[model samples]
Target: MSRKAYSFVRGFSAQPARDLCVDRHYLLCASTGALRLAAADRVWLLPPARAALIEAGHPVRVDLPQPATTASVLFDTAFTTPPPAPLTVFDLSPLARALLAECGQWGASEEPLTAYAETLFAALAAVTWRLAEQPSPVVLPAGRSPLLRHALRFTGERLGGEIRFEEVAAEVGLAPRSLARRFATETGMTWRATLRRMRVLRAIEELSAADTPVTTIAHRVGYTSLSAFNAAFQELTGRTPTEYRASFRP
Candidate 1:
């Protein structure tokens, strides 16, 4: 309908790098699988139980490693106030999910919305803003400096193996202490914490596949001990791997 608010749905089965920037506020959720969104200074792991609110005109890179069904709504700037952050990933409650599903019925129409449709969108917008108050921890901060960026890249590429701060620093041509300082300054997280966050986020990507075993996912993310993997995952996400996966189950 009119640009006040409109719904869009899509299914993605393969990995594709999509760089997106639109003039309308984007509320995106994956009803079936997971989505990885990378902005300039942050990365968010959006699971089925979560949704990300992207401010209008903010560019982001989207990645879908597994098959996923996405239900998204774009709101005209005049229709609602902006969220506090440029991008926010938050837990999606049942009511919010229902609202999104119902709104999907008005998918990307060119005509004006009926009065009833307008009311429905207004309610959905209220619920979305309220739920966005408590942001989720399934996000990682990105570094700005080239050295720090290189270090992050190195750590990400070697997530399946043991990653040491010293090793990363050496690869990036910096001392361990200096690199640690850079990480804290640029990413607002200590090197060890950043590494742990990376592993956990990567594990989430693997967990998105329904057929993958938890033990396999743990090892794939560089955890030699399943117990440690479970504890780390729970500490960051507040849910065990199995519990998180169960959220996607019908």
Candidate 2:
């Protein structure tokens, strides 16, 4: 059997993007900018000192404010023990952060680094599961409009498929003009802008997973062609799919 790659990225945030799951699981820490995850009727807000646990096959939407820094780890599906729930925000303990920092500086030493990283990974998973068991306050946007909520749910369900404004408007029983206005008013973003973020979030999951090819992943996530996918991925991630995969090697 082929071994799955584990991905790690640590850098300053540039802009907001969307990510859809491929096969890998993601653990993310954002020093600034908020991260949002929406699954069906559920939408979550991850603030500082919190990390988001994104499961495979779930479509997540992310938004980063002006400037932010983030550290993320992508591991194979097999590596993740089942969480009590699909998504949870956990406190990134001091030890978890320190270990992640050490892993960042481990360089090319596979021996010691691998062992230490595994330990850290275990601790991270435990913390996330523990947090999931405990109820944390959930914050949903105040006065969220029905149209915006409908759009978000529609996006999450169809992350791997195509989406059009007209289709979304029809689903929500609104005209295109009316839907656009409602989206902006409730979500603080245009329908197109929200769709773009949703697409990027789906792409992140595809890029992080092991079995999917970049071209296929791109098409699956709504890019018409490979070039478009590459451009979008680079714009959001600062690295190509191949380069990102290499960072995750175990």
Candidate 3:
């Protein structure tokens, strides 16, 4: 499997932290249950109807729960250019999901398997194009407010350190009340909510690397205590830090 130019994995089980040193891009689509894919800078929360695109040689660790079904394919870079980013979590419609499953089921000698891989790759490329033309299913708001923009730049620069809201407002020549109101009005989320989201997203990226412990991640992301970070993480993503990091463990 390690030396093969193409591979397909379909099963009803879980996978521990592992790395494949192949020059083939990997596409994973989940049909039922849930799986977590952990990479260097991102932890993908993959559920039904979601797909993850990973670049060739970019290591990922997979963890799955019981009653789970997923189809993954490894193909040459000729199929599609490397993803523009390190990680992209996009919606996968049912029809495309079935197509992916069908692609995963092809079994034959290496001679045929390699050719069949091209057909599968083409289909996936076409499917990806169609999905891109449609609106993104997952929309995290990034509003345009000059003051808010300045405030964001100011806040973002000091993510792991202290974030004094009043000081931020004062520097920008706006009252704290006005800053909160304008931020909520423009971003559709309160200042605190935005801050939490930013921290959590950054935390997710850091967690995938396995370089940091859960306790340090909480503090690194500005959580005063581990318990507080756990509650906030679960409240937003339905998973705790330990559980999320477990998906990346060997």
Candidate 4:
């Protein structure tokens, strides 16, 4: 019989510009770099400490701002049920990491999986589905409307510096109050909350992709005080900037 699951490692020099969909369930995590995954409703930053599980046929845009190596596994539907969410970004457990490390040696083969390999894959899938129940807070919601999209784009561009709701509203041609309502309506987050999330998301990308110092990264993402940055980062990610960056070490 054909293999029910396989794993592969891929490297990207630049971010892919298009969305991708696949027929098999996918577990994607960065082994030596970082990943940014954007789905319909949410965007995720995956460093070595986190993973994104995508259900078969779900379209997602993957961004690798830095040259990165990704170790991922693909499972045939016959081997496991669909995940609870269409796409779930969650913390990667030690067991899941160990399983992926072992399975990754196969390197995307079509040959039949041995019984031991089958069992290992099954265990990994089980752990994945369970972990999906607890999604990570390190995600930002995406916006759909044109005005909201414009506002989001502006915020992303300005994340490295201070951003105010009034500035964004004026830039997007909406009143401050009106823009706040739009943000809550479309993304289900207040303008302040969204900005905080956006800043931390950018910090995660930097933390994962470079050797920049924590204080520098904190300021780069618009925080004036290092203590304030640590509080916000830990509130969203449960890890300080230094600790989070250390996770990427081999």
User: How accurate locally, in lDDT, is each candidate?
Assistant: 0.86, 0.61, 0.64, 0.85
Question: What's the lDDT for residue 179 in model 1?
Answer: 86
Per candidate, the number of residue pairs that clash is 1, 9, 0, 0
Off by over 4 Å in 4: none
lDDT tens readout by residue for model 3, 1-250: 3323343656565546455444676666655555556555334556555677667787776655334566676666765666655445666765666667666565423554456656665777568546645432222344476777778767767778888899889878999999988887877778778777767756765665445888898888898888888887777666786665554322
Q: How far is candidate 2 from the true structure (C-alpha RMSD, Å)?
A: 13.5
lDDT of 1 by residue, 106-132 (tens): 877678888888888889889988888
lDDT of 4 by residue, 1-250 (tens): 5579998888889666568799999998877677778898678877766788999999999887777888889899999999989887888888988888888766566588889998999999999889989998878878888889889889989988777889999999999989988988889899888889988988888887778898999889999999999999999878898888887764
Question: How well does candidate 1 score on lDDT at residue 133?
Answer: 80
- After superposition, the stretches of candidate 3 with alpha carbons farther than 4 Å from their true spots are 1-88, 91-115, 122-140, 248-250
As for lDDT, the candidate ahead, 1 or 4, is: 1
TM-score of each: 0.94, 0.49, 0.51, 0.95
| Model 3, position 145: C-alpha lDDT score | 61
2 versus 4: better lDDT goes to: 4
Error of 4 at 214 (Å): 0.7
The RMSD (Cα, Å) of candidate 1 is 1.6
Q: If ranked by lDDT, best first, what sequence of candidates would result?
A: 1, 4, 3, 2
lDDT of 2 by residue, 60-151 (tens): 76655334456676655776676666666655666656655654543323343356566666666666556666533333332276667776
Q: Which candidate is the best by TM-score?
A: 4
lDDT of candidate 1? 0.86
